[model samples]
Target: MSKYWNEEIECMSREDMKKLQSERLVTQVKHVYENVPYYKKLMDEKGVTPDDINGIEDLHKLPFLTKADLREAYPYGLLAKPLSDCVRIQSTSGTTGKRVVAFYTQNDIDIWENCCARAIVAAGGTKDDVCQVCYGYGLFTGGPGLNGGSHKVGCLTLPMSSGNTERQIQFMMDLKSTILCCTPSYAAYIGESLKEMGYKPEDNKLKAGIFGAEPWTEEMRREIEKSLGIKAYDIYGLTETSGPGVSFECEEQTGMHINEDHFIAEIIDPKTGEVLPEGSKGELVFTSITKEAFPLLRYRTRDICVLTREKCSCGRTLVKMSKPMGRSDDMMIIRGVNVFPSQIETVLIEQGYSPNYLIEVDRVNNTDTLDISVEMNAEQFSDTIKDIQKKEAELVAAIKTMLGINPKVHLVSPKSIARSEGKAVRVIDKRKLH
Candidate 1:
């Protein structure tokens, strides 16, 4: 079996990759500057024109775009192609604000699917495999992206858009699904559900899982891998960047390889917005070079991570990005300290608690308070309040040691926390910060 879906491009030399990126980026910039008035305005303000950007080296000259810019543009402000040319529109969950609607031309869709197919292939997917896609469909990009890619790979795709866990498992067993795609949290939930349904990790035919759409910890990754008896690979993307195929993990299991031919990845100092050197952990930024309908240049992803050009065992020369540590916007400041949900999650998983947990932040008596409600596995659940308190105290200490800020820990019953087939709600901040 071929190890790569597009070996020619995936393993292209750095010089060739940069040349391709430069060419596409030049054309894309002209297209956006000519068609998208909002971005043109941004560029004009920055005194940058298409003539200024010759190649990837000049990418730093482009102005940055943020979620705020997308919201300001709303439905069609940043569209480069006409609605007639756009074949589809995939959107964000709108949980943060106005849903970011991304237009896709048929060519755009083809390239996006090709990117996804690369991800599936990296996860060891082949035409003979049954690829089950459970990401939420409709406006959300997860379902459609993987679904298209599965078809491209000639896998018998199960477009079982997220939810209905029982039906998902039934299909998994009946059809003998070889690859599963969904959010990491949902994958964990499915793992927990399989155990409850009297199925061992190896009972099903699943050999691999491609999980993304939400931030997850390494500990959670190992847990899911053990529960499903499959190598759980991480895929990363946003609706703004045409969904979960912008980058994907390979057998190396180190970091996701960004599809650099389609998108240029950069790390920037979050506060100053200066592009950081390679290996520096900072805010992640992307510039879509080939996207026709809605190409975003220098779009700030708010994700904190590093990028490395280090050669890989997989032989793909594409740049690899560390799994995002946390989003700049998602970072919580409590008691004059910065805390990320992933840090808390790491502590929970290490402490042998269920990955399903809730973090609630609030202010009382003019002081910020942090409380974490962690679900206890069946074996750990006890009727004794003192035992529970002791466990909670231990967890508090562990978390404090990790985060440097003490958090009130509440151990709750297994299955008490609401299960989500979509992105799991991890934090609920009640503080009013204007």
Candidate 2:
């Protein structure tokens, strides 16, 4: 039987779910317009008022909030409640630009954890299960969000932050952790380490894994599943919208079910800013109806995906979002051709290579150069220079066939590329530096 943490809400009829969302959205809009001057200014500039938003249908009329807006707001610009009311704050890694800090009241934390608990339950988690979380702790939402959810599910929680691979494996063996939570890349690395230690796939007790905070291909999913002897599940969330439980995969892994009662999702044309109908692939937009501290209305997520209302076998009426094909911002335009890292990753896995690879793009003599360095699996590594050159040529041809752009492929030593404990850094655009 498929288990659910909140079946009543998850399986609610579409009419009833919309009713609930409409009510919460009305109240939330009023709350923000009254308390958040920054957002109020945005509404004023757009000539939109709290009264203008009658329900979810009016959500499209509101202006979208982007990452640039968050940076402009900085610490207090988007906060809807006073600091005293907020019990916690989580922040983005800020590797790209200024760190975006998100505040959460006690109520906000409770709701966020409940959303994550639903994900855990959907992934076959129970109070009797031991959950091991390897996502980074403090500031980052992945660790704290899943940690709280594990507690809500009454599971024996291991708050192991990322790093110390040997120690992480030891705890998994000693405590018999049944559920593993971490980034898909780190999970892949752990699987490699386990095999290196001579531990078979069945040597551990983990049955399922919740991997997120980064984009991963379906080929990588099967790799992790075979290497770890566990079913891999994807969880989606952002620090701006209360972390890793905004949506999650159920028993049926076709797509992740968005928690509709708490959030309203829309697919919008990235260039035109027009709302697209269901099944149209475009940028994702979200409105947090239940958030109290930092409620974002029509936040632009920049993720390219499609939403489907098709009925699911899990019996959850929540709408499902297809795995994000790629980010609009991450798409690389080289030689007048668009290329995404995911396309390269898919080809790599299909050609019997590890998922670890780095892409470098630069402009030399005003001509764009595309170079890719892929980590060769130890089992496939060749000591002979001729053999290794042959391998690189073969991979370059495969990638060219997929991307329609010839790339210079260099096969690096196994594990030579730095592994990411959080989100992997795959692209190096030296053109920006120049």
Candidate 3:
């Protein structure tokens, strides 16, 4: 565990990468066999042992860990280290059952900082810049992870963990923070707050923003950048995969590059659990080959995405995954038609409407009905209410062509919708029983 942290592993060659992963994988399996009862029982049931997982090629033989497995184990059941050795813990919001808590040793914290540092650097962040972390800190993974990474990057880090948009803007002005990190919804909310406070974007002197923890479209990115007058970059990760620095978008803005050396990423079919080749859309699976405190094997992330092996001009050897559209659980089924809220955002933005929209689904007379509410910018509000009604009608027709279903569309004033600081709750499916 003391030997888990490595900072100078950035320039590892392909062969070096294989050797490092192979060595760490075996060592981790042995550690799990000795210290973790859950993994040991799983191995015994499969009639396999640490000796069988000798290298990366033998990964297929090990039992895959999933959300269900974590749930069955509950809290502290998968720790391969002693409680005295563990320093920190982070849990997923679960929302369905007991939270999935991940234990971390000091070594785990150091490696997380290294990964976050890579993400910051990829987004053109430098030591000269001041980092303002806006993601919520305790229990959630985004804030503290980026805070540590920004500190390690030799920058003046502001641990302003989310909320209080007005105060966040004030600190941004007073401290002159150049780098901002938070969820996309928060960024958009802060943008609206800035406008409400009559603050000019040019006055804050922010240069770049690293946004993650929720899925967002490029249209939303453009809106955030335009509102804040800064370059907005995407950082992708989950608590199951070491949080915010698992993948990151470079200056090219093409896609997020997965840090393949620390964690091996694969896209597999959600239903069949069969690995799909590069460029095929599937669920993202991660194998924490280098983790010590909680090294998850073939962990199903349930994120639908595609990967590309083609080398990018950024010079990073990591593989790139497309921005996730939606989670498999988050997918909507309406009258035998599959729909994603992202598709609605795409249509709204393409038609020159604000990206802020909400979907409401209800069952009446045994038929599901969907209603969408979109906020109309002040620029679109002119003359009278009739004009707004006419525009709303046009948008309703536009959505019909897009979604192939006529969804009741309503237009509301700008800033009238509920602002989300972290994750946005867009859909209200009354038909789905809790």
Model 3 worst lDDT run, 10 consecutive residues: 1-10
TM-score head-to-head 2 vs 3, winner: 2
Clash number for candidate 1: 0
- The reply for model 2, stretches above 4 Å from the true place, is 382-386
Candidate 3: global Cα-lDDT?
A: 0.82
C-alpha lDDT values of all predictions: 0.94, 0.93, 0.82
Where model 1 places Cα greater than 4 Å from the true spot, the runs are 382-384
Candidate 1 on 1-434: residue-level lDDT in tens? Answer: 69899999999999999999999999999999999999999999999999999999999999999999999998999999889999999999887767889999999999999999999999999999999999999999999999999999999999999999999999999999999999999999999999999999989999999999989999999999999999999999998989989999999999999999999999999899999999999999999999999999999999999999999999999999999987766788998898889999999999998899999999999999999999887789788989988999999999999999888998887788899999999999999987
Clashing residue pairs in candidate 1, if any?
Answer: none
Ranking of candidates on lDDT, top first = 1, 2, 3
Q: Pick the winner on lDDT between candidates 1 and 2.
A: 1
RMSD of 2: 1.5
Q: Could you tell which candidate, 2 or 3, scores higher by lDDT?
A: 2
- lDDT of candidate 1 at residue 216, scale 0 to 100: 94
- On TM-score, the candidate that comes out on top is 1
lDDT of 3 by residue, 133-245 (tens): 99999989999899999988877999999888888999998989899999988998887678778877786789889999887889989988988989999998888767788
